[model samples]
Target: MEIKGENISFRYNIDSDWILKDVNIFLKTNQIIGLMGSSGSGKSTLCKILTGYINNYEGDVYLDGEKVNNNGFNPIQLVFQHPEKTINPKWKMNKALNESWNPPKELLDKFGIQQSWLNRWPNELSGGELQRFAVIRALSPKTKFLIADEMTTMLDAVTQVQIWQNVINIAKERKIGVLVVSHDKKLLNRLCDETIHLNIPFKIFFI
Candidate 1:
Protein backbone atom coordinates (compact mmCIF):
# COMPACT_ATOMS: atom_id res chain seq x y z
CA MET A 1 0.00 0.00 0.00
CA GLU A 2 1.20 3.51 -0.85
CA ILE A 3 1.36 5.93 2.09
CA LYS A 4 2.27 9.51 2.89
CA GLY A 5 2.73 11.51 6.06
CA GLU A 6 2.04 15.25 6.12
CA ASN A 7 3.09 17.46 8.98
CA ILE A 8 2.90 14.54 11.35
CA SER A 9 3.56 15.28 15.00
CA PHE A 10 2.83 13.22 18.12
CA ARG A 11 3.00 13.57 21.90
CA TYR A 12 2.01 11.15 24.60
CA ASN A 13 0.39 13.60 26.97
CA ILE A 14 -0.34 17.31 27.24
CA ASP A 15 2.34 17.76 29.87
CA SER A 16 4.99 15.84 27.94
CA ASP A 17 6.78 17.36 24.97
CA TRP A 18 6.20 16.20 21.43
CA ILE A 19 8.00 13.01 20.47
CA LEU A 20 7.86 13.42 16.70
CA LYS A 21 7.72 16.94 15.31
CA ASP A 22 6.73 18.29 11.93
CA VAL A 23 7.65 15.17 9.99
CA ASN A 24 6.76 14.83 6.34
CA ILE A 25 7.32 11.81 4.15
CA PHE A 26 6.13 9.99 1.07
CA LEU A 27 6.78 6.24 0.57
CA LYS A 28 7.14 4.71 -2.85
CA THR A 29 4.87 1.80 -3.62
CA ASN A 30 6.40 -1.65 -3.00
CA GLN A 31 9.54 -0.10 -1.53
CA ILE A 32 11.25 -0.63 1.81
CA ILE A 33 11.52 2.60 3.83
CA GLY A 34 13.72 2.24 6.89
CA LEU A 35 13.20 4.29 10.04
CA MET A 36 16.52 4.45 11.88
CA GLY A 37 16.86 5.86 15.38
CA SER A 38 18.18 5.34 18.88
CA SER A 39 16.15 3.55 21.55
CA GLY A 40 14.13 6.59 22.64
CA SER A 41 13.96 8.32 19.29
CA GLY A 42 10.21 7.70 18.82
CA LYS A 43 10.70 5.31 15.90
CA SER A 44 8.21 2.90 17.46
CA THR A 45 5.82 5.78 18.08
CA LEU A 46 5.99 6.71 14.43
CA CYS A 47 5.32 3.12 13.48
CA LYS A 48 2.31 3.02 15.77
CA ILE A 49 0.86 6.15 14.25
CA LEU A 50 1.44 4.92 10.73
CA THR A 51 -0.16 1.54 11.41
CA GLY A 52 -3.17 3.07 13.20
CA TYR A 53 -2.01 1.43 16.46
CA ILE A 54 -2.06 4.83 18.15
CA ASN A 55 -4.72 7.03 16.58
CA ASN A 56 -4.76 9.76 19.22
CA TYR A 57 -2.08 11.82 17.51
CA GLU A 58 -1.75 14.83 15.24
CA GLY A 59 -1.51 15.16 11.41
CA ASP A 60 -2.83 13.04 8.60
CA VAL A 61 -1.75 9.60 7.35
CA TYR A 62 -2.94 8.88 3.84
CA LEU A 63 -3.16 5.45 2.23
CA ASP A 64 -3.67 5.50 -1.50
CA GLY A 65 -4.62 9.21 -1.12
CA GLU A 66 -7.36 8.57 1.47
CA LYS A 67 -6.91 9.72 5.06
CA VAL A 68 -6.36 7.06 7.73
CA ASN A 69 -8.08 8.14 10.93
CA ASN A 70 -8.39 4.60 12.23
CA ASN A 71 -7.34 1.07 11.41
CA GLY A 72 -10.07 0.45 8.87
CA PHE A 73 -8.40 1.76 5.73
CA ASN A 74 -4.74 1.11 6.52
CA PRO A 75 -3.92 -2.53 5.97
CA ILE A 76 -0.51 -2.37 7.63
CA GLN A 77 0.69 -5.43 9.52
CA LEU A 78 3.45 -5.51 12.12
CA VAL A 79 6.14 -8.04 12.99
CA PHE A 80 7.24 -6.81 16.40
CA GLN A 81 10.66 -7.32 18.03
CA HIS A 82 9.68 -9.89 20.64
CA PRO A 83 7.88 -12.89 19.28
CA GLU A 84 6.92 -14.09 22.78
CA LYS A 85 5.21 -10.82 23.48
CA THR A 86 3.16 -10.92 20.29
CA ILE A 87 2.19 -14.57 20.29
CA ASN A 88 -0.22 -16.04 22.80
CA PRO A 89 1.16 -18.24 25.56
CA LYS A 90 -1.68 -20.70 25.70
CA TRP A 91 -2.33 -21.09 22.00
CA LYS A 92 -0.48 -23.71 19.99
CA MET A 93 1.70 -22.59 17.10
CA ASN A 94 -0.69 -24.13 14.65
CA LYS A 95 -3.55 -22.22 16.23
CA ALA A 96 -1.65 -18.97 16.10
CA LEU A 97 -0.72 -19.58 12.47
CA ASN A 98 -4.30 -20.45 11.69
CA GLU A 99 -5.50 -17.19 13.18
CA SER A 100 -3.31 -15.19 10.87
CA TRP A 101 -5.04 -13.27 8.07
CA ASN A 102 -3.45 -15.70 5.65
CA PRO A 103 -2.63 -19.23 6.61
CA PRO A 104 1.06 -19.74 7.41
CA LYS A 105 1.65 -22.49 4.84
CA GLU A 106 2.12 -20.27 1.80
CA LEU A 107 4.30 -17.73 3.57
CA LEU A 108 6.43 -20.39 5.27
CA ASP A 109 7.20 -21.92 1.89
CA LYS A 110 7.98 -18.51 0.46
CA PHE A 111 10.39 -17.82 3.31
CA GLY A 112 11.98 -21.26 2.92
CA ILE A 113 10.86 -22.28 6.38
CA GLN A 114 10.26 -25.98 6.79
CA GLN A 115 6.59 -26.96 7.00
CA SER A 116 7.08 -29.22 10.04
CA TRP A 117 7.90 -26.27 12.29
CA LEU A 118 4.27 -25.23 12.27
CA ASN A 119 3.32 -27.94 14.76
CA ARG A 120 5.89 -26.78 17.30
CA TRP A 121 4.77 -24.55 20.12
CA PRO A 122 6.29 -21.14 20.71
CA ASN A 123 8.43 -22.46 23.55
CA GLU A 124 9.65 -25.38 21.48
CA LEU A 125 10.80 -23.16 18.63
CA SER A 126 14.15 -21.42 18.49
CA GLY A 127 14.44 -17.67 18.57
CA GLY A 128 14.99 -17.55 14.83
CA GLU A 129 12.08 -19.88 14.24
CA LEU A 130 9.76 -17.75 16.32
CA GLN A 131 10.83 -14.59 14.54
CA ARG A 132 10.30 -16.19 11.16
CA PHE A 133 6.86 -17.39 12.22
CA ALA A 134 5.96 -13.92 13.42
CA VAL A 135 7.00 -12.51 10.06
CA ILE A 136 5.03 -15.14 8.23
CA ARG A 137 1.96 -14.25 10.24
CA ALA A 138 2.33 -10.57 9.40
CA LEU A 139 2.82 -11.08 5.66
CA SER A 140 -0.30 -13.19 5.26
CA PRO A 141 -3.03 -12.48 2.72
CA LYS A 142 -4.57 -9.41 4.34
CA THR A 143 -1.29 -7.57 4.56
CA LYS A 144 -0.81 -4.71 2.11
CA PHE A 145 1.82 -2.84 4.04
CA LEU A 146 4.22 -4.17 6.71
CA ILE A 147 5.39 -2.15 9.73
CA ALA A 148 8.38 -4.05 11.02
CA ASP A 149 9.30 -2.37 14.30
CA GLU A 150 12.71 -3.73 15.20
CA MET A 151 11.42 -7.07 14.06
CA THR A 152 14.69 -8.97 13.82
CA THR A 153 16.72 -7.20 16.52
CA MET A 154 16.98 -10.15 18.88
CA LEU A 155 18.07 -12.76 16.37
CA ASP A 156 21.62 -13.87 15.71
CA ALA A 157 23.54 -12.29 12.84
CA VAL A 158 23.02 -15.18 10.45
CA THR A 159 19.30 -15.45 11.16
CA GLN A 160 18.87 -11.70 10.85
CA VAL A 161 20.47 -11.73 7.42
CA GLN A 162 18.32 -14.63 6.32
CA ILE A 163 15.08 -13.06 7.52
CA TRP A 164 15.96 -9.72 6.02
CA GLN A 165 16.62 -11.24 2.63
CA ASN A 166 13.38 -13.20 2.72
CA VAL A 167 11.32 -10.19 3.72
CA ILE A 168 12.84 -7.86 1.13
CA ASN A 169 12.47 -10.35 -1.70
CA ILE A 170 8.90 -11.34 -0.83
CA ALA A 171 7.78 -7.77 -0.26
CA LYS A 172 9.07 -6.59 -3.61
CA GLU A 173 7.65 -9.57 -5.41
CA ARG A 174 4.23 -9.00 -3.89
CA LYS A 175 4.34 -5.22 -4.31
CA ILE A 176 4.06 -4.82 -0.54
CA GLY A 177 5.22 -1.59 1.03
CA VAL A 178 7.54 -2.10 4.02
CA LEU A 179 8.09 0.44 6.80
CA VAL A 180 10.99 -0.85 8.87
CA VAL A 181 12.07 0.71 12.18
CA SER A 182 15.54 -0.51 13.06
CA HIS A 183 18.98 0.60 14.25
CA ASP A 184 20.93 -1.75 11.97
CA LYS A 185 22.53 0.35 9.25
CA LYS A 186 23.90 -2.67 7.39
CA LEU A 187 20.54 -4.36 7.21
CA LEU A 188 18.82 -1.12 6.25
CA ASN A 189 21.34 -0.49 3.50
CA ARG A 190 20.94 -4.03 2.25
CA LEU A 191 17.13 -4.28 2.34
CA CYS A 192 15.77 -0.76 2.04
CA ASP A 193 15.48 1.28 -1.10
CA GLU A 194 15.35 4.48 1.01
CA THR A 195 16.54 5.16 4.54
CA ILE A 196 15.51 7.93 6.95
CA HIS A 197 17.24 8.66 10.22
CA LEU A 198 14.94 9.72 13.03
CA ASN A 199 15.47 10.47 16.77
CA ILE A 200 18.24 12.98 16.24
CA PRO A 201 18.61 15.37 19.18
CA PHE A 202 17.14 18.21 17.11
CA LYS A 203 17.54 17.65 13.39
CA ILE A 204 15.12 15.76 11.13
CA PHE A 205 15.21 14.83 7.46
CA PHE A 206 13.30 12.37 5.27
CA ILE A 207 15.89 10.77 3.03
Candidate 2:
Protein backbone atom coordinates (compact mmCIF):
# COMPACT_ATOMS: atom_id res chain seq x y z
CA MET A 1 0.00 0.00 0.00
CA GLU A 2 1.26 3.46 -0.90
CA ILE A 3 -0.03 6.84 0.27
CA LYS A 4 0.52 9.61 -2.21
CA GLY A 5 -0.13 13.35 -1.89
CA GLU A 6 -0.21 15.24 -5.14
CA ASN A 7 -0.26 19.03 -5.55
CA ILE A 8 -1.69 19.67 -2.11
CA SER A 9 -2.39 23.27 -1.21
CA PHE A 10 -4.36 24.57 1.74
CA ARG A 11 -5.39 27.88 3.24
CA TYR A 12 -7.89 28.94 5.84
CA ASN A 13 -9.44 31.42 3.41
CA ILE A 14 -8.71 32.85 0.01
CA ASP A 15 -7.40 35.99 1.62
CA SER A 16 -5.17 34.05 3.99
CA ASP A 17 -1.65 33.09 3.10
CA TRP A 18 -1.28 29.54 1.85
CA ILE A 19 0.12 27.20 4.48
CA LEU A 20 1.05 24.50 2.03
CA LYS A 21 1.41 24.44 -1.75
CA ASP A 22 1.95 21.84 -4.41
CA VAL A 23 3.29 19.16 -2.07
CA ASN A 24 3.93 15.68 -3.37
CA ILE A 25 4.91 12.56 -1.50
CA PHE A 26 4.91 8.83 -2.19
CA LEU A 27 4.91 6.86 1.04
CA LYS A 28 4.72 3.10 0.75
CA THR A 29 3.56 0.73 3.45
CA ASN A 30 5.93 -0.60 6.14
CA GLN A 31 8.46 2.20 5.78
CA ILE A 32 9.42 4.84 8.35
CA ILE A 33 10.01 8.30 6.95
CA GLY A 34 10.86 11.66 8.47
CA LEU A 35 9.34 15.05 7.65
CA MET A 36 11.04 18.20 8.94
CA GLY A 37 10.81 21.94 8.43
CA SER A 38 11.15 25.19 10.31
CA SER A 39 8.46 26.33 12.70
CA GLY A 40 5.36 27.50 10.77
CA SER A 41 6.71 25.72 7.70
CA GLY A 42 3.55 23.58 7.42
CA LYS A 43 5.01 20.27 8.62
CA SER A 44 2.19 19.61 11.07
CA THR A 45 -0.34 21.09 8.67
CA LEU A 46 0.66 18.59 6.01
CA CYS A 47 0.46 15.77 8.51
CA LYS A 48 -3.13 16.75 9.23
CA ILE A 49 -3.88 16.94 5.52
CA LEU A 50 -2.45 13.48 4.85
CA THR A 51 -4.62 11.80 7.47
CA GLY A 52 -7.87 13.54 6.41
CA TYR A 53 -7.96 16.00 9.29
CA ILE A 54 -7.96 18.91 6.84
CA ASN A 55 -9.96 17.77 3.83
CA ASN A 56 -10.46 21.14 2.17
CA TYR A 57 -7.03 21.20 0.61
CA GLU A 58 -6.54 21.51 -3.13
CA GLY A 59 -4.60 18.29 -3.78
CA ASP A 60 -5.74 14.72 -3.76
CA VAL A 61 -4.47 12.11 -1.35
CA TYR A 62 -4.47 8.52 -2.55
CA LEU A 63 -3.91 5.18 -0.91
CA ASP A 64 -2.85 2.40 -3.26
CA GLY A 65 -4.03 4.47 -6.23
CA GLU A 66 -7.53 5.09 -4.84
CA LYS A 67 -8.72 8.49 -3.62
CA VAL A 68 -8.68 8.73 0.16
CA ASN A 69 -12.15 8.83 1.65
CA ASN A 70 -13.09 10.84 4.71
CA ASN A 71 -15.57 8.57 6.36
CA GLY A 72 -15.03 6.86 9.71
CA PHE A 73 -11.81 5.65 11.31
CA ASN A 74 -9.18 6.18 8.68
CA PRO A 75 -6.63 3.55 7.74
CA ILE A 76 -4.19 6.44 8.16
CA GLN A 77 -4.11 7.57 11.78
CA LEU A 78 -2.62 10.73 13.25
CA VAL A 79 -1.48 11.40 16.81
CA PHE A 80 -1.27 15.09 17.48
CA GLN A 81 1.05 17.23 19.60
CA HIS A 82 -1.57 17.90 22.26
CA PRO A 83 -3.38 15.00 23.89
CA GLU A 84 -5.89 17.27 25.60
CA LYS A 85 -7.38 18.35 22.29
CA THR A 86 -7.95 14.79 21.07
CA ILE A 87 -9.63 13.12 24.05
CA ASN A 88 -13.08 13.81 25.43
CA PRO A 89 -13.15 15.60 28.76
CA LYS A 90 -16.20 13.71 30.02
CA TRP A 91 -14.78 10.25 29.37
CA LYS A 92 -12.60 8.28 31.72
CA MET A 93 -9.17 7.31 30.51
CA ASN A 94 -10.26 3.72 30.03
CA LYS A 95 -13.31 4.76 28.04
CA ALA A 96 -11.21 7.04 25.89
CA LEU A 97 -8.64 4.34 25.29
CA ASN A 98 -11.31 1.78 24.46
CA GLU A 99 -13.35 4.11 22.30
CA SER A 100 -12.19 2.34 19.14
CA TRP A 101 -10.89 -0.99 20.43
CA ASN A 102 -9.80 -2.72 23.60
CA PRO A 103 -6.07 -2.21 23.53
CA PRO A 104 -3.90 -5.14 24.58
CA LYS A 105 -1.88 -5.17 27.79
CA GLU A 106 1.40 -5.20 25.91
CA LEU A 107 0.60 -1.83 24.38
CA LEU A 108 -0.29 -0.32 27.72
CA ASP A 109 2.77 -1.86 29.34
CA LYS A 110 5.12 -0.67 26.64
CA PHE A 111 3.99 2.90 27.26
CA GLY A 112 4.30 2.38 31.02
CA ILE A 113 0.61 3.11 31.50
CA GLN A 114 -0.43 1.82 34.89
CA GLN A 115 -3.75 0.07 35.34
CA SER A 116 -4.68 2.52 38.07
CA TRP A 117 -4.56 5.45 35.70
CA LEU A 118 -7.36 4.06 33.57
CA ASN A 119 -9.99 4.99 36.13
CA ARG A 120 -9.04 8.65 36.20
CA TRP A 121 -10.12 11.48 33.92
CA PRO A 122 -7.97 13.22 31.31
CA ASN A 123 -7.22 16.23 33.53
CA GLU A 124 -5.90 14.03 36.33
CA LEU A 125 -3.00 12.67 34.35
CA SER A 126 0.07 14.63 33.27
CA GLY A 127 0.54 15.54 29.62
CA GLY A 128 3.08 12.81 29.07
CA GLU A 129 0.82 10.20 30.62
CA LEU A 130 -2.21 11.28 28.63
CA GLN A 131 -0.23 11.23 25.40
CA ARG A 132 0.41 7.54 25.95
CA PHE A 133 -3.29 6.91 25.52
CA ALA A 134 -3.40 9.05 22.38
CA VAL A 135 -0.62 7.06 20.75
CA ILE A 136 -2.23 3.82 21.79
CA ARG A 137 -5.54 4.85 20.32
CA ALA A 138 -3.94 5.71 16.98
CA LEU A 139 -2.23 2.34 16.80
CA SER A 140 -5.34 0.28 16.42
CA PRO A 141 -5.22 -2.79 14.19
CA LYS A 142 -7.13 -1.00 11.45
CA THR A 143 -4.43 1.67 11.08
CA LYS A 144 -2.28 1.16 7.98
CA PHE A 145 -0.29 4.40 8.22
CA LEU A 146 0.62 6.46 11.31
CA ILE A 147 1.45 10.14 11.48
CA ALA A 148 3.16 11.15 14.71
CA ASP A 149 3.28 14.94 14.76
CA GLU A 150 5.56 15.81 17.65
CA MET A 151 3.68 13.11 19.53
CA THR A 152 6.30 12.81 22.27
CA THR A 153 7.20 16.47 22.65
CA MET A 154 5.76 16.65 26.14
CA LEU A 155 7.72 13.62 27.37
CA ASP A 156 11.21 13.66 28.78
CA ALA A 157 14.17 12.40 26.81
CA VAL A 158 14.10 8.95 28.39
CA THR A 159 10.37 8.57 27.94
CA GLN A 160 10.63 9.82 24.37
CA VAL A 161 13.26 7.21 23.60
CA GLN A 162 11.20 4.47 25.17
CA ILE A 163 8.02 5.45 23.32
CA TRP A 164 9.83 5.68 19.98
CA GLN A 165 11.45 2.30 20.46
CA ASN A 166 8.10 0.71 21.13
CA VAL A 167 6.55 2.51 18.16
CA ILE A 168 9.27 1.24 15.82
CA ASN A 169 8.81 -2.28 17.12
CA ILE A 170 5.06 -2.12 16.61
CA ALA A 171 5.41 -0.67 13.13
CA LYS A 172 7.88 -3.31 12.06
CA GLU A 173 5.78 -6.11 13.46
CA ARG A 174 2.53 -4.84 11.98
CA LYS A 175 3.98 -3.64 8.67
CA ILE A 176 2.60 -0.15 9.27
CA GLY A 177 3.97 2.86 7.46
CA VAL A 178 4.96 5.69 9.82
CA LEU A 179 5.58 9.36 9.26
CA VAL A 180 7.74 10.88 11.98
CA VAL A 181 6.98 14.60 11.76
CA SER A 182 9.18 16.74 13.94
CA HIS A 183 11.89 19.38 14.06
CA ASP A 184 14.20 17.19 16.11
CA LYS A 185 17.01 16.29 13.74
CA LYS A 186 18.53 13.76 16.13
CA LEU A 187 15.29 11.89 16.55
CA LEU A 188 14.56 11.94 12.83
CA ASN A 189 18.07 10.71 11.97
CA ARG A 190 17.74 7.95 14.52
CA LEU A 191 14.34 6.63 13.40
CA CYS A 192 13.61 7.48 9.79
CA ASP A 193 14.70 5.66 6.63
CA GLU A 194 14.70 8.81 4.49
CA THR A 195 14.16 12.43 5.45
CA ILE A 196 12.14 14.98 3.48
CA HIS A 197 11.79 18.70 3.89
CA LEU A 198 8.54 20.65 3.72
CA ASN A 199 8.77 24.13 2.31
CA ILE A 200 6.95 26.22 -0.27
CA PRO A 201 5.57 23.84 -2.94
CA PHE A 202 6.09 20.95 -0.44
CA LYS A 203 8.47 19.13 -2.68
CA ILE A 204 11.22 16.73 -1.56
CA PHE A 205 13.90 19.39 -1.94
CA PHE A 206 16.40 17.74 0.37
CA ILE A 207 17.21 14.22 1.57
Candidate 3:
Protein backbone atom coordinates (compact mmCIF):
# COMPACT_ATOMS: atom_id res chain seq x y z
CA MET A 1 0.00 0.00 0.00
CA GLU A 2 2.92 2.33 0.59
CA ILE A 3 1.23 4.42 3.29
CA LYS A 4 2.75 7.47 4.94
CA GLY A 5 1.52 9.78 7.68
CA GLU A 6 3.41 12.90 8.79
CA ASN A 7 2.88 14.32 12.28
CA ILE A 8 -0.71 13.09 12.38
CA SER A 9 -2.73 14.49 15.26
CA PHE A 10 -6.46 14.39 16.04
CA ARG A 11 -8.92 15.67 18.65
CA TYR A 12 -12.54 14.65 19.09
CA ASN A 13 -13.62 18.23 19.59
CA ILE A 14 -11.92 21.61 19.71
CA ASP A 15 -11.97 21.86 23.51
CA SER A 16 -11.83 18.11 24.04
CA ASP A 17 -8.75 15.97 24.62
CA TRP A 18 -6.59 14.89 21.74
CA ILE A 19 -6.52 11.19 21.01
CA LEU A 20 -3.43 11.07 18.77
CA LYS A 21 -0.54 13.53 18.86
CA ASP A 22 2.22 14.11 16.35
CA VAL A 23 2.16 10.56 15.03
CA ASN A 24 4.53 9.89 12.14
CA ILE A 25 4.39 6.48 10.54
CA PHE A 26 4.59 4.71 7.20
CA LEU A 27 4.17 1.26 5.70
CA LYS A 28 5.78 -0.28 2.63
CA THR A 29 3.81 -2.36 0.15
CA ASN A 30 3.04 -6.02 0.92
CA GLN A 31 4.16 -5.81 4.55
CA ILE A 32 2.24 -6.73 7.68
CA ILE A 33 2.72 -3.98 10.29
CA GLY A 34 1.27 -4.13 13.76
CA LEU A 35 -0.06 -1.11 15.61
CA MET A 36 -0.03 -1.80 19.35
CA GLY A 37 -1.03 0.37 22.28
CA SER A 38 -2.93 0.40 25.54
CA SER A 39 -6.63 1.12 25.45
CA GLY A 40 -7.37 4.79 24.63
CA SER A 41 -3.75 5.24 23.54
CA GLY A 42 -4.94 6.42 20.10
CA LYS A 43 -4.58 3.13 18.25
CA SER A 44 -8.19 3.21 17.11
CA THR A 45 -7.93 6.93 16.45
CA LEU A 46 -4.98 6.34 14.19
CA CYS A 47 -6.95 3.68 12.27
CA LYS A 48 -9.86 6.08 11.92
CA ILE A 49 -7.64 8.83 10.55
CA LEU A 50 -5.92 6.41 8.20
CA THR A 51 -9.25 5.14 6.86
CA GLY A 52 -10.63 8.68 6.48
CA TYR A 53 -13.31 8.10 9.16
CA ILE A 54 -12.39 11.17 11.24
CA ASN A 55 -10.97 13.56 8.65
CA ASN A 56 -10.74 16.70 10.75
CA TYR A 57 -7.12 16.02 11.67
CA GLU A 58 -3.86 17.92 12.08
CA GLY A 59 -1.64 16.31 9.43
CA ASP A 60 -1.68 14.57 6.09
CA VAL A 61 -1.93 10.87 5.21
CA TYR A 62 -0.68 9.60 1.91
CA LEU A 63 -1.28 6.35 0.04
CA ASP A 64 1.26 5.45 -2.65
CA GLY A 65 2.98 8.84 -2.08
CA GLU A 66 -0.16 10.75 -3.05
CA LYS A 67 -2.04 12.86 -0.46
CA VAL A 68 -5.24 11.01 0.43
CA ASN A 69 -8.08 13.00 -1.03
CA ASN A 70 -11.18 12.71 1.14
CA ASN A 71 -13.16 9.99 -0.57
CA GLY A 72 -15.92 7.88 1.01
CA PHE A 73 -14.44 4.37 1.13
CA ASN A 74 -10.72 3.98 1.66
CA PRO A 75 -8.52 1.73 -0.44
CA ILE A 76 -7.34 0.82 3.04
CA GLN A 77 -10.34 -1.01 4.51
CA LEU A 78 -10.88 -1.76 8.21
CA VAL A 79 -12.17 -4.77 10.09
CA PHE A 80 -13.80 -3.39 13.21
CA GLN A 81 -13.44 -4.88 16.71
CA HIS A 82 -16.95 -6.33 16.49
CA PRO A 83 -17.82 -8.07 13.28
CA GLU A 84 -21.51 -7.73 14.03
CA LYS A 85 -21.19 -3.97 13.79
CA THR A 86 -19.56 -4.20 10.38
CA ILE A 87 -22.02 -6.84 9.11
CA ASN A 88 -25.62 -5.86 8.74
CA PRO A 89 -27.99 -7.65 11.09
CA LYS A 90 -30.89 -7.16 8.70
CA TRP A 91 -29.03 -8.82 5.83
CA LYS A 92 -28.17 -12.43 5.24
CA MET A 93 -24.54 -13.46 5.15
CA ASN A 94 -24.57 -13.56 1.36
CA LYS A 95 -26.20 -10.13 1.12
CA ALA A 96 -23.75 -8.61 3.57
CA LEU A 97 -20.87 -10.32 1.83
CA ASN A 98 -22.07 -9.05 -1.51
CA GLU A 99 -21.66 -5.48 -0.24
CA SER A 100 -17.95 -5.88 -0.82
CA TRP A 101 -18.54 -6.87 -4.48
CA ASN A 102 -18.54 -10.39 -5.90
CA PRO A 103 -16.63 -12.76 -3.65
CA PRO A 104 -15.60 -16.14 -5.00
CA LYS A 105 -17.82 -18.98 -3.82
CA GLU A 106 -14.67 -21.01 -3.24
CA LEU A 107 -13.58 -18.61 -0.53
CA LEU A 108 -16.40 -19.77 1.74
CA ASP A 109 -15.18 -23.34 1.53
CA LYS A 110 -11.63 -22.16 2.07
CA PHE A 111 -12.71 -20.38 5.25
CA GLY A 112 -14.56 -23.55 6.38
CA ILE A 113 -17.88 -21.75 6.33
CA GLN A 114 -20.68 -23.80 4.85
CA GLN A 115 -22.84 -22.65 1.96
CA SER A 116 -25.92 -22.91 4.20
CA TRP A 117 -24.57 -20.09 6.37
CA LEU A 118 -24.81 -17.83 3.34
CA ASN A 119 -28.59 -17.68 3.75
CA ARG A 120 -28.42 -17.16 7.51
CA TRP A 121 -28.64 -13.89 9.39
CA PRO A 122 -25.81 -12.42 11.44
CA ASN A 123 -27.61 -13.27 14.71
CA GLU A 124 -27.66 -16.96 13.75
CA LEU A 125 -23.86 -17.15 13.67
CA SER A 126 -21.35 -17.47 16.48
CA GLY A 127 -18.96 -14.61 17.16
CA GLY A 128 -16.10 -16.53 15.59
CA GLU A 129 -18.15 -17.40 12.53
CA LEU A 130 -19.24 -13.80 12.14
CA GLN A 131 -15.66 -12.62 12.43
CA ARG A 132 -14.52 -15.05 9.77
CA PHE A 133 -17.26 -13.84 7.49
CA ALA A 134 -16.25 -10.27 8.17
CA VAL A 135 -12.66 -11.02 7.24
CA ILE A 136 -13.63 -12.66 3.98
CA ARG A 137 -16.05 -9.87 3.23
CA ALA A 138 -13.37 -7.25 3.75
CA LEU A 139 -10.60 -9.10 1.88
CA SER A 140 -12.58 -10.80 -0.88
CA PRO A 141 -12.25 -8.77 -4.07
CA LYS A 142 -11.57 -5.08 -3.42
CA THR A 143 -9.20 -4.83 -0.45
CA LYS A 144 -5.58 -3.70 -0.88
CA PHE A 145 -4.47 -2.72 2.59
CA LEU A 146 -6.36 -3.90 5.67
CA ILE A 147 -6.54 -2.14 9.04
CA ALA A 148 -7.68 -4.94 11.28
CA ASP A 149 -8.63 -3.15 14.52
CA GLU A 150 -8.74 -5.65 17.34
CA MET A 151 -10.63 -7.93 14.94
CA THR A 152 -10.60 -10.99 17.13
CA THR A 153 -11.26 -9.35 20.49
CA MET A 154 -14.75 -10.88 20.71
CA LEU A 155 -13.74 -14.41 19.73
CA ASP A 156 -12.59 -17.26 21.94
CA ALA A 157 -8.85 -17.95 22.18
CA VAL A 158 -9.07 -21.02 19.96
CA THR A 159 -11.09 -19.24 17.33
CA GLN A 160 -8.82 -16.24 17.59
CA VAL A 161 -5.78 -18.34 16.78
CA GLN A 162 -7.53 -20.03 13.88
CA ILE A 163 -8.72 -16.73 12.44
CA TRP A 164 -5.29 -15.20 12.73
CA GLN A 165 -3.78 -18.20 11.03
CA ASN A 166 -6.17 -17.85 8.13
CA VAL A 167 -5.48 -14.15 7.87
CA ILE A 168 -1.71 -14.56 7.93
CA ASN A 169 -1.83 -17.32 5.33
CA ILE A 170 -4.06 -15.32 3.02
CA ALA A 171 -2.05 -12.12 3.54
CA LYS A 172 1.18 -13.83 2.59
CA GLU A 173 -0.37 -15.55 -0.41
CA ARG A 174 -1.98 -12.36 -1.65
CA LYS A 175 0.93 -10.13 -0.71
CA ILE A 176 -1.56 -7.73 0.84
CA GLY A 177 -0.47 -4.93 3.13
CA VAL A 178 -1.86 -5.32 6.64
CA LEU A 179 -1.86 -2.94 9.60
CA VAL A 180 -3.12 -4.97 12.54
CA VAL A 181 -4.07 -2.82 15.54
CA SER A 182 -4.22 -4.79 18.75
CA HIS A 183 -3.28 -4.80 22.45
CA ASP A 184 -2.32 -8.49 22.33
CA LYS A 185 1.43 -8.65 22.22
CA LYS A 186 1.45 -12.37 21.52
CA LEU A 187 -0.83 -12.10 18.50
CA LEU A 188 1.22 -9.23 17.10
CA ASN A 189 4.42 -11.18 17.54
CA ARG A 190 2.93 -14.22 15.89
CA LEU A 191 1.08 -12.67 12.95
CA CYS A 192 2.98 -9.53 12.02
CA ASP A 193 6.29 -9.34 10.15
CA GLU A 194 7.01 -6.16 12.08
CA THR A 195 5.47 -4.80 15.28
CA ILE A 196 5.18 -1.22 16.48
CA HIS A 197 4.34 -0.10 19.99
CA LEU A 198 2.33 3.07 19.98
CA ASN A 199 3.32 4.31 23.41
CA ILE A 200 4.71 7.70 24.45
CA PRO A 201 7.05 7.19 21.54
CA PHE A 202 6.39 4.76 18.72
CA LYS A 203 8.72 1.76 19.09
CA ILE A 204 8.95 -0.15 15.83
CA PHE A 205 10.68 -3.49 15.21
CA PHE A 206 11.15 -5.99 12.45
CA ILE A 207 10.63 -9.37 13.97
Top candidate by lDDT: 2
Which run of 10 residues does model 3 get worst, by summed lDDT?
A: 198-207
lDDT of 1 at 81: 68
What are the lDDT figures for the candidates, one per model?
0.77, 0.89, 0.79
Off by over 4 Å in 2: 200-207
lDDT of 2 by residue, 50-148 (tens): 888888999789988888876887899989988899999999999999998899988899899999999999999999999999999999998899999
- What TM-score would every model get versus the actual structure? 0.86, 0.95, 0.88
The best candidate in terms of TM-score: 2
Give residue 22's error in model 1 in angstroms: 1.4
Error (Å) of candidate 2 at residue 58 is: 0.6
Q: Could you give me the TM-score of model 3 versus the true structure?
A: 0.88
In model 1, where do residues sit more than 4 Å from their true spots? 69-74, 102-106, 109-117, 120-127
Once fitted onto the true fold, the runs of candidate 3 whose alpha carbons sit more than 4 angstroms away are 69-73, 200-207
lDDT of 3: 0.79
**Which residue pairs overlap in candidate 1's backbone?**
none
RMSD of 2: 1.6
* lDDT winner between candidates 2 and 3: 2
**Positional deviation of 11 in candidate 2, in angstroms?**
1.1
